[model samples]
Target: MSKGLTRRSMIAGSAASVLAAPALAQELPDTVQIRESLSSTTRRNTASFRAIQWRAHFPNLRNGAILVDIDSRALHLWQEDGGYHVYPSSVPQSAEMTRKGRTRVVRKVVGPTWRPTPNMRRRNPEWPAVVEPGPNNPLGTHALYLSWTYYRIHGTHDTRKIGRRSSSGCIGLYNEHIAEVFGMTKIGTQVLLI
Candidate 1:
């Protein structure tokens, strides 16, 4: 067989090129509609994730501030000293279940017990009325009770719930994240859900 320009070599090179064509063709989308769709999606996902200054939402960080961005599934906290931190969170499952505006962290509990609210019981008749503080507790390891009744910024054992809309009417964080927030927050910490 000839060393160069053989029919077998040409056929093999052609086959390899054919097999690689689809991979090489997978380039960035260029169509206007597709580009617009991707742009909108990226904006929707990232617009809320951008770091927000506390002044935009609060007059002062007296007792510290907690801003829950439901749309982004994130919680942003500003310590009284101007320290800022962001954490992924789980938000209420529906608009009706969401409450916007201001509230305070009126209470903080570690190893918090879980109780199905009257409305919750009505909605989930089979759910237990009380859940003692433990692994099965929905409030995870800590809870920050809001001024609004039945509303809390708490922890969840279900890690999958973070960065999602899974809660009935509360914001949820990872147990570890909540533990960190719990340590830094005060009873009078300002809380806002938006």
Candidate 2:
């Protein structure tokens, strides 16, 4: 073959080989930005539990947290960046333990008053003549007030009965854990139960 024709043939063969290769065989397009996670310094602050003295020996738990697993009767506190603490929980005998939606934080109030809902009243006619917030309240030492429908993750006065089916539809944490969490979390954080 003529030298010029040979050069053209080689160029055509090279082009065909390049086109036949898998798309992924080539370097990623410049438009695709490869992202790296934040440095250690940028990780979420390990929540402080200074006010809850009982946790002095326990390590500070991770990022944005989580709670409740109906099937397991376990409450898991998860951090957004990745870490979790699991504790046994209790669900109500009458209350269904299904997690319907996203998880969020219990940002405010400890030892919240128990104002039994009209439904709660209907269930237990003698629930309370009038409810008030204090240590004597069934809510125990802490209640994590969530953003959706009057729900909370709290400590129950009855600790011996945890890890079973038994609350009015709130996620129950140990009193000590709730106090620590109540101090660390803030309003408007994400919460999920599954």
Candidate 3:
């Protein structure tokens, strides 16, 4: 092999590195920072209370990892300790939107506003251009924005929708559950959607 680097070789090398990078480093860090956690002290001590199915679902799951099981309609935050917190989640019913992959928690926000996408507005002409954060807002009270394209794991205005498939692409959790998940996750938290 010669010492000189070719353009094609360099491009290939860069692509290889990107493809092999850790899931957490796949995206740029967000401007927002998580400054607080929800009931961390109390939740960490409940490892003994986990059900057999929960443990069986992830035998070697990483700590501080967020796993979203689309088929099961559940979201789990594996605590820094050995315990885990499970919450019912509502995933998208659209086959094209039910994606399987890994992403990172890029942002966390309380009282998130809902901006109707152009496509959404096209589908529903009556849909408001923007919905300010409130009881009626679909984003509920908290949200964990993922690195994936326009997808967020957020709280829902309708608690009855939990454990059901009824979203465009984002994962929906109960208002209270999302609040806890928002507190539990931080920037760069690995989110596996399966």
Candidate 4:
């Protein structure tokens, strides 16, 4: 071994250089590129996932609060004790299908059966009137029924729906996420869709 270097040192240095090479090869973005990306629609959409104060939307946590941001496709929950959680969600397919305002969780159902609304049936004449609780059920494994007749915060088996505007009117979360939310929420949990 040399006075200042050894086989171990050489091997470690070589490994460090190899690990750093890809990072070094990548060029840093210019100011213009950074500015353009910041202003892009994608950035605007993703920026919606940022944390929001519960007080801005809710008068009080009461039983708890669930805030669904339609534009950002995100759901936020604030428990009465100040616990906070956020999840990516699926919103209504279009503005016409969206119902915005305050509502409460009127019911919580596990292994929920789904029934299409009259309007849903009218829109898709071929669609089934009843869907039993199963993998094919649009409601997934859990649902929190809203005060509004046809609106719900539920789970979707179709994961691609989350973080996108793909629901008929309900807010949809991944099944596992919904199950977790289901356990956290109560029948009177406050909900606001905006």
TM-score of each: 0.76, 0.60, 0.67, 0.76
Segments in model 2 whose C-alpha atoms lie over 4 Å from true places: 1-63, 80-83, 94-99
Worst ten in a row by lDDT for model 2: 45-54
Look at candidate 4 and tell me the lDDT of residue 68.
Answer: 92
Clashing pairs in 4: none
Global lDDT of model 4: 0.80
Cα lDDT of model 2 overall? 0.56
Cα displacement (angstroms), candidate 3, residue 170, comes to: 0.9
Model 1 clash number = 0
Per lDDT, the best of the predicted structures is: 1
What is the alpha-carbon lDDT for the whole of candidate 1?
0.81
Model 1 lDDT per residue over 1-194, tens place: 66898854664565455445553242212111111222343324433465667889999999999999888787889898876667778899999999999999999999999998898999999999899999999999999999999999999998777777899999998898899999999999999988
Candidate 3 Cα lDDT to native: 0.69
- Sort by TM-score, top down from the best: 4, 1, 3, 2
Least well predicted 10-residue stretch by lDDT in candidate 4: 28-37
Where model 4 places Cα greater than 4 Å from the true spot, the runs are 1-48
User: In order, what lDDT does every prediction score?
Assistant: 0.81, 0.56, 0.69, 0.80
TM-score of 1: 0.76
lDDT of 4 at 66: 97
